[model samples]
Target: MELRDDQPMQHEIGNRTYIVADVDPLDVDGVRTVEVGSALWLLGFLALLPFYGELEANGRVWWLWACLAGFGLGLFGLEYCRRRRKARAERDGLDHG
Candidate 1:
């Protein structure tokens, strides 16, 4: 894991060599973030519903539908990430069925 000075990622700035940090990526599975996003999109759709008439008149009604679509897609992503996290945990012998 040691990076040499000749590595492509090594940078020399003012006689100082900067190399990429050796760190493991996060494994939070992103379910919480997806839930938050889905909630926000749902809230946006609900908030815009009251102004549907104005939005349609101004030809911006797609914004509301877009929010709904985002919420729906987020729902799918949430389930997918949750399943992935659970599978990983089970495979690692961390969480038993």
Candidate 2:
């Protein structure tokens, strides 16, 4: 059977290939996921900090700071990764001229 040229074909000349709408895996890689993952890890680590307290209550409450630090690091990493990716895209001429 012959395929019509006007119509969009599911397969190309030789092989049958599947077309995916979301082709880029890192398309959604950004500050959001990093922040969330860091927050979770920090929270897990902080939950064990209570052991540092003597007589049930004698140590510094650093879990809050830990969370903040994780947040900051996540944000920074997101920004850095974004800029790096942008630079790469620009070098590759992927960005709109």
Candidate 2 lDDT tens digits, 1-97 = 7744454434455666755353334555364677677778677556655555542364444655666577678777877777776877798789832
lDDT for 25 in candidate 1 is 60
* lDDT at position 57, candidate 1: 100
Alpha carbon lDDT of each predicted model: 0.91, 0.62
Cα lDDT tens digits for candidate 1, 1-97: 9855555666789989998775666778898899999999999999999999999999999999999999999999999998998899988988833
Global CA lDDT computed for model 2: 0.62
Model number with the top TM-score: 1
RMSD of 2: 9.8
Q: Where is the poorest 10-residue window by lDDT in model 2?
A: 20-29
Question: After superposing candidate 1, which stretches have Cα over 4 Å from the reference?
Answer: 1-11, 19-24
* lDDT measured at residue 79 in model 1 versus the true structure, 0 to 100: 90
- Any runs in candidate 2 off by more than 4 Å, and if so which? 1-35, 38-60
